[model samples]
Target: MMHVPPQAADARAKTGIPVLDERLRGGFPRPSTLLLFSDKPTEKRLFGENFAVQGVKAGDTSLYVDFFRAPQLARGELKRFGTIDPSKLVFVDATSSQLLLPSQEKYRISDIGSLTNIREAIVSAIEATAPSRIIVDSMEFLMDRFDKDDVLRLWHELIEAARANRAVICFLFINWTLLEEDLAQIRSMSDFVVEFQSSVRGGIVRNSMRISEMAENGIRTNWIPYAFKDLIGLTVYFPRILVTGPFNAGKSTVVRALAEKAISIDRMGTTVAFDYGNVNITGIEAEIFGTPGQERFEFIFKIFAREVSGVLLVIDATRPEELPRAKQMLDLVGPRIPYVVLANKSDLVGALSTEDIAHRMGLPSDVPVIPTVATESKGVRDALLLLAEMIIGVR
Candidate 1:
């Protein structure tokens, strides 16, 4: 009997999206095949494009097989993710042949009508460039032209290529024409299947994704809401980080200080509804939703607290009497969800110490109470960083 050492799993390749990377336990294992599928009309290709662009940004070679758009158009869209080094990216343009346009890319699929041409072009590029990542923009082009058996054979070849080169390959598919059995077979071949969908509620469209299957190193399947930002792609994002506390605690001030841009729903110099702001801090991206501190507007907590990643319990340090009301607001956010105390106006005369504030609130010793002067943005970043760490369970 031969004693053979088990091979170590491939190193993770981060997608440049912090939250999504956290969900993948750092990122996807190299050489794995991912099927990014959607049943509804959604921006599924953006996920795959981001995957390739992430590789290129990491100084690894990436091959993008574009079936729907021109190479120039694809390049333009890639700019939304971030600046890229063109030398690191190679394109297999399948669109040029269909449009009868001269392909400017180095690698060209000369004929889209023939499955053999598409397969050969893709395989040759995979072998020639040896990309660390590959993305087939959409399988619709191949599906519309070739038989299922032919496409299946091509799919097998893709898997084999990924295996041979230790590269991750992602196939983007919109599930309108495919039969259930066909979809099942495709899923069976993939190492990970990511299903995404979008819905509009209250005139706001929300998009989310979930890993439906994983053959090994199984994932806890959950629909994680995400959004694409300019120069940052596919964030497993939360649109709200409920910032709440008692009146005159600087909830709105903290939100404004933390956000690059903000809008407050206020009248008569008091927040009547909520303060909304988009925050990108310490590599964690989220929308900060600051609740009105007055007890009368407590009903609005139902609107802002939903799907919040964490809470920032703001209270005026000078007024320790407000600590009880601040603690009460935490109940609205609920238990089990991590939060940090922000003792704002700490620099004011006769302000209570962080220890005194926690004691007054009857919070446990481990509960962090960070002092801040929202007017000057003091301790604001630190408070946000601590809350972010707590939300991701890094603390």
Candidate 2:
């Protein structure tokens, strides 16, 4: 029997997308395989490239293995994001000879006879540069050229080699190009899968991302909306505080008042599942998620509560007896999660005072309870700002 030494713990890296990072816990795990699938060109590939450039900018050596684009063309595309250090960024030219005959400047060319040669070049590059991150900006082209079994063999070999050397590997695959079985196998082997989809709603293009098969402690988020800027990599739109409470507590009205554009997924004038809205304060960027107040739908709480910066607990001011139910809902999320209480419908003739509602709910002295009339948007901004402060630990 042979005794092997223990390997060091994997180092985590940031994706530079704040909201996405929050959902990912920290970032992609080091020495793990990430698959990015998309039907459209440029969208997914650019994301992978930006990730590589972000690694380089963070002082980590990164390798970009291009099987489709020329090295200079890839570099030019990357420059749109930000300035990258030439020395820290290395390119494995796998498509140059495919476009033209072999030349002196060509680093490595991908051909039928020398398919193994490309794998060797990749392994050598990893050993030589010792990069923390490597992006094979795509596996689709290689999969098309080589036999299915051979491609999988090469993929396993190269990925295992990269992992042994403690480098994270990202393989970009086009979902529509590969066979269903091949795609399924690749996804099963991958540590994370990020899928991109674009839809036209009301004549507007909306890009969203869906994440599957994440690493341990991975916080799964809903289809988060994002966009690419010329300089910034990816900017995610984060929702404001999600307002939740007992059944018929005016949660929907609160979101409608607080949000510039809001949608209520209610049933028969009462919320049954969830609500979504967008709030843009002068100095704040927030999205509001309102969970169903019905006790039957409490399971949705865990899903929405994963990355919540703070929570807003809404209570009907007229129904003081329901305060305990609201408190119980907060208790479901556990302590240490920041939350504010809203005494909604205060404009009604016999509504409870903020302090009375808080006292009845047995809330701590530090908790702030604001009186609100959700129908008129009164105190909505104030409540959200207070929740934001609590999330940031300022209040």
Name the candidate that leads on lDDT.
1
- How close is every model to the real structure, measured as TM-score? 0.77, 0.63
**Candidate 2: 10-residue stretch with minimal lDDT:** 1-10
Rate residue 345 of model 1 by lDDT. 94
lDDT of 2 by residue, 122-141 (tens): 88777777787889878778
- What are the per-residue Cα lDDT tens digits for candidate 1 across 1-395? 22222225747778776655766777888778999998866877878887888889888889999888888888887888878899888999888889898988878999888888888889888888888889997886677778879988998998897777778899988877888998999999998898889988678898877775466647645566677778866665666788899987899999999999999988999998989998875346788898888888878987777767789989999987787788888887888777999989999899999988877778987789998999999999889877765665444
lDDT on C-alpha atoms for all candidate structures = 0.82, 0.76
Give the poorly placed runs of model 1, Cα more than 4 Å off: 1-10, 100-102, 248-250, 261-274, 299-311, 315-395
Query: Superposing all C-alpha atoms, what RMSD in Å does each candidate have to the true structure?
Result: 5.5, 10.1
How many clashes show up per model? Answer: 0, 4
Model 1 residue 60 distance off true place after TM-score fit, in angstroms? 1.6
> What is the model-wide C-alpha lDDT for candidate 1?
0.82
The collision pairs in model 1 are none
